[model samples]
Each structure stands twice: as structure tokens, then as C-alpha cells.
Target: MFKLLFLVLLAASVHQARPDGRIVNGETANSMAVAPWQVSLQTSYHFCGGSLISPTHVMTAAHCYQRFGVTVHFGSVSNANSPNVFDVSTFTQHPSYSTGITTDYDYAVIKMAQSASMNSNTQDIALPDDTDYTGQTAQISGWGQLSGSGGTPTLLQVATVPIVSEDACKSQWGNLRITDRMICAGGAGTSACMGDSGGPLAIKDSSGKWVLLGNTSWGSSSCTTNTVSVWSKNANQLSWINGQMNS
Candidate 1:
């Protein structure tokens, strides 16, 4: 069965779960009405999170892209009540993305059938620079589940977690390959759980502008477990992302 790259449901709830991840531990419902760039990727039967990087481009994890069919929804926090829906005209995943084998290079970009109209509820987020974000505080937002048996929430969820150093992440993950292209965050019960995959893991820079640093990728087998959640490093792939948009 094709699964969302990061989702791992409770063994008992497997049959009833949707392939997804959510913010666990230190999560709060987003109080504000607008997360301008936040978007939802709805497939024929399931959904994933994403971020709008431009009027015509949405950044997400490669695994979230369903070649069969996908639609992008913006301007709403409730996945079931999104008012703006756009058909995906095309998409491109990292050249190295492969299913069930590697999580490296798990990023992708989607081109909408029509450009999104910028409004108070819809806008693009800035990409990150070369500065290393280790130790920096970052925020992750998604509509993923609150618990293993708990279904995903209708309201968007947000969490703040510090970026974990590569050394510590590698030490924790042990035999698992922890590449420089990946950024580790949220351990000790706080993490990006099922359904959060493909959503932006962003940081507010010195200028107070939120810069996208990564996107939810994969994590431990359970949301309640103490594990380092891994994200696709956005800074490392900026060149590739720009090249695709410009080409």
C-alpha cells in the first residue's frame, strides 16, 4: 500500500487511520486566523500539508505528491472547509526521491493550474539563507493528529521546537542515515506526528520574517515516543528549488 512518507499509526488503530502526522506534546491551536502561506494537499482520499513559496509554487515533501490526482487548498485552516482550491497542473520531486528506501532529498514543488491570488489570508513565505539554524527556535504547523487513536483536527495546529544539532541527531538515530540534507527537531515527546509530513518547518529570522528552513519528512514510529523528527533541509535545496522555478 502507498503510504504518506512519515505516518505510523498505532498498531491497534491501523485500519482506521489515515496516513498522516501531527504536532504532539507542545502543540496549540493556532489562535490567529491566517497562516498566509500554509496550504493543504488533498488527494483522492487523503491529505497532507504544504507551504506556498510563490504564487504558482507550493513546496512539499516528494512523498505527498500523488501522480493520480492532487488539489491544493489555501486560505483556510480547516482542511475540510478550505475555500480556495486549485488543481495542480504539474509537480517535480527531488531527483533522488525513492519510496520506502530513503528519506533523503524528499522535497518537491507543485505548480498550480492557476496562480493564487495574494490576499490577507494568502501569501508566500520567504526561503532561508545559508545561515545554519542549529539551536534556533522554529515553528511547525499542520492539521495532523493529536494522538495515535485521535483523528486529525479540523483546526490547524502549531508547535515550537528548537533545531537539533546534526551530531546529536546522528547519535540518536544510530544506524539510520542522517545526512546533512536533513534537519532534526523535536524530541522528548514533542514532535511532528502523522499528517504533518510535507508541511514547512520554519524559523523567524532576525528581521522577524518567517523563513522556511525545512519541511516535515519522517520521524519515530509513534507520536508519543521520544524521538527526533527529521525534516528535509530547505536551505540545502534552495538552488534546486530556484532552478526549477526559473527553468
Candidate 2:
């Protein structure tokens, strides 16, 4: 059911494969929390991953669906054990997505033909509302391998990191343009890596609700090292996301 294979291309010098590290089970850390039944989008065709954002919608990096026949599985933490699989019915890459830059807007939404069944183990995550994530700490989760060398973890893995400013990210990346269309977070040598892409970069809202601030984007070559994530904080994009969920 992968539909847009022609569009997804690997970024040059970008470490698209998972890294080698010890298997760390999911846990709560600051604003990061793992949702039950969240699955990683792994298939023979592509090495990237995604998260189940709702009963019918899965949030992932737009680059992950560039391959045809890519399959996604839910209800399991390990890639080998996940038997509940679904075919993507529709793929929607953000209209502004471009691969020209190092981390150009890389978010996308996938619609499955059937709705996912939610239980205590599985649930939809809340989206952030007009909240400034700058200077706030966030968490990211994924079932992908610990490092490029380690196998996919048997349980979900999560890590804590603080958000960075666009100016800081651009200064670090040098030539790349860190625009207002994106928000960055990381430092203190803790960050998300290859397998964490398209996952949630979340923060707590004023109401104590865990709202998604960023879809895991690219980062440094390693996870334990300092990393920066590009987030979507534009008002128009936030409204568009709310509209999608409500509609």
C-alpha cells in the first residue's frame, strides 16, 4: 500500500539507518511518555519509522513513505514481533516539504484504510495548542534499534532533551537555513537518533495535557550526543493539524 515511492529519496550523508546501542525500554521522563500499542513503520523497502497519532492517522517523516509498498505494523514494540500490519491508503506530505536543505520540513500524515482499535495499551496523543515550546524540555519515543548496530528494541525507548532556538540550530548546522517554520530542541548531549524520526517531540500544555510539538526530524549521527529537532510551530500549520484531527 505504499503509494509515493518515487518521491522519497535518501538524503546524502544522512544516517538513515538505526545505530547500535543498548536496548532501553520505554519510561516516563519529564514530558516524554510512551503510548501503548504505538508501532514503528518498518518494512523491507525502507529503514525509517513513524508513530500512530490517531485511530486512523499515523504521523511519520515524509521521507519514509517515498518507497512503494512500504508496510507499517502496530501493537508490537519489536520489528520482528509486530504482526498487526496495515496498508497505507493515502499519503499526505506537508505541502511545504522540500529535500533541498539539510532538514527541510520533513513531516507527513498517513491514512490507513481501517481505523486502529484503541485500548489502555493504545491511544491517540494530544496536539499542542499555540503553546511556545521554546526553552521547554521534551521527550521522544521509538521502537527502532538502539543504535545503528543494535537490533530493534523489544520495548519502546524514550529519551529526554530540551528545545533549542531556530537561531541556535542554524548556527550549529552552518549552511542550513533554520526557519520559523521549524523549532529545534536539544543539548546536554541527550537527543533522538535515526529510528526516532517522525515520532513525537512532546511537551505539557498549560492544562497538563501532553501535546505534540514536533514530529521527530533529523538529528546528529548519534543519540547519546547532543542533537537538535526541527519542529512545526507556525499558527497556520497548527490550525491545519487541528482541522485534520477534528474533520
Predicted model with the maximum TM-score: 1
Candidate 1, poorest ten consecutive residues by summed lDDT: 10-19
Give a tens-digit lDDT track for model 2, residues 1-247. Answer: 0111122223443433122112123343222125452456655632555556678887766655554576667665555566467877776777767666444556677777778787655566665566666777776666545653445544566766677766787666543445666666765655555555666666667778766776655554444354454544433276555555555
Steric overlap count per candidate: 8, 13
As a TM-score, model 1 comes out at 0.87
| Per-residue lDDT of model 1, residues 1-247, tens digit only | 0124543332322222122467775454454234678888888533778899999999988877689679998887677788888999888899987543346788899988889888877889988987887887888888777765567777778778788899988776643456868888877556777777788888888889888888887765556445667788988889999987776
